[model samples]
Target: MRCFVTGAAGFIGSNLVDRLLAAGHEVVGYDNFSTGQRSFLEGAGRSAGFTLVEGDLLNPDVLRPAVAGCDIVFHLAANADVRFGTHHPFKDIEQNLIATFNVLEAMRAHGIKKIAFSSTGSVYGEAAVIPTPEDAPFPIQTSLYGNSKVAAEGLISSYCEGFGFQGFIFRFVSILGERYTHGHVFDFYNKLRNDPSSLEVLGNGKQRKSYLYVQDCIDAILIAVERADAKINIFNLGQNEYCEVNQSIGWICDRLGVSPKLSYTGGERGWIGDNPLIFLDCSRIRALGWTPKLSIRDGVVNTLEYLMANPWVLDARG
Candidate 1:
């Protein structure tokens, strides 16, 4: 199968690209390097079946050509930062909502039928249930980033109904693993590496969320695309276990061999529009014969090891 993956230079997108290439599929990678790293895609480009297109999803000309001749489109490009949306709300809307419009238009023009969208767990917005299901009500988003994702999901569903395309929406939880650029774990590790004595957490260290390894996320995408028979299939992609912020901080400290003083900025939500507790019920996806392989502690240790070896976190700070 020929696949066109947006944000293909990003952590999860690049990982998926590698998996597809390994499985003997031709992959055209589309990325503008907005938040994605070039090194991630460069490593995958070494493979014979991978092609990289330097382009933005906001531009129809770029998207149309990049998506041409692709059997499946994995739309992962977006303004993924939660805090950034607080300061620059329009940035999220433009990158996520407007960019998705361009992708849909391009797909419609080219008659591309299948799209595996990278939605967010933020769309659930402080779920009343511990493990929120796909049927859970989507409240009005607290952050513009979440709202933009909700809008994008709606657009994809509209396209699926109106244009006869298959749309797979995977609302992802906290994703941590190789090639990760930003997140709570990365922030915690960087703080400890710089000042091991005092660690400044963004919020009160009580916020709880589910963490999923990048491999598991990619696996869910593959499973959804292969088995989805619905016109619009939505799945919550996350680990079954939930980890508190302080617990995750302790895990990082233990892995780094540092006993740091923990400080907090005071609040349940780490940042504006940040959901305090996010635990997704992934039984919907698990019922499809896919389950997360790495536990929370295992995933954190693996990420810490990767950070130590690659030194991307140090470079990211500098």
Candidate 2:
């Protein structure tokens, strides 16, 4: 199969690209480096079956050529930071909504049929159920980032229904693993690496959420692509276990061998659109014969080890 992955240099996208290439598939990767890094795609470039295209999804010229001759399109590009959306709503709108429209349009033009979209658990907002299912009603988004994802999902659904494209939407939880340039784990590691004496947490540390390792995330998408035959299939991708913010801090502290003074701004939700608590009912995806192997502690430890080895951060505090 020939696959085109947008945000191909991002943490999850890069991981997925490697998996696709390993499965003997030709992959064309596209990224603007907005949040993605070229270093993440370096390994894929070395593969004979892999090709990289430098471009933004907002540009049809770049998108159309990048997506040409691809059997499946994995649309992962977006403004991923939830906090950034609060500061710049238009940035999220353009990067997510506009960028997604361009991808769907390009796919339509090329007569491509399948798309596995990278949606978010944030789209569910604050769920009433502990393990929310695919049938769960997605509420009005709490943040601009979440709103943008909701819009993107809608666009994909519309394309599937109106244009007869096969689509799979995976609503992802907190993803943590190697090649991660940003996220809670990365933020904590950098803070402690620079100043081991103090760690500033975003929320009051009581907020809880589900997490998924990068490998598990990639595997779930693969399963979706291979098995999904519906016009629009939706799945919640996450680990079954839930972890609190303070518990995550403790795990990081234990792994890094640093006990810092933990301080937090008082709030349930960390930011404007942040959901304090939400656990995914991954049974939908699990029923498809895929399950996450990494526990919260295991995933955190692995991520810490990766950061220690990679050292993407600088000793600027010194």
Per-model TM against the reference: 0.97, 0.96
**How does candidate 1 fare on TM-score?**
0.97
How well is each residue in 1-318 modelled by candidate 1, as lDDT tens digits? 999999998888999999999888999999998778888877687888888999888778777978889998999988887887778778988999999989989988898999989999999887777789999887766888889999999999999999999999999997889887778777787777778999998889999878899998899899888887999999999988898989988888887888988889999978889998989999989999998999988888888888888886458544
Model 2 poorest ten-residue lDDT run:
309-318
Would you list the C-alpha lDDT of every candidate in the order shown? 0.88, 0.87
Output the number of the lDDT-best candidate: 1
Q: Supply the TM-score for candidate 2.
A: 0.96
lDDT of 2 by residue, 1-318 (tens): 999999998889999999999999999999888667778888899999999998988889878977889999999988887876767779989988999999999999999989999989988888776788878877766878888888999999999889999899999998888886677888888889879999999879999888888998898999888887788999999987898989989989998888899888888877787899879888988888997888978888888888889885323211
Candidate 2 root-mean-square deviation in Å: 1.8
Regions more than 4 Å wrong, model 1: none
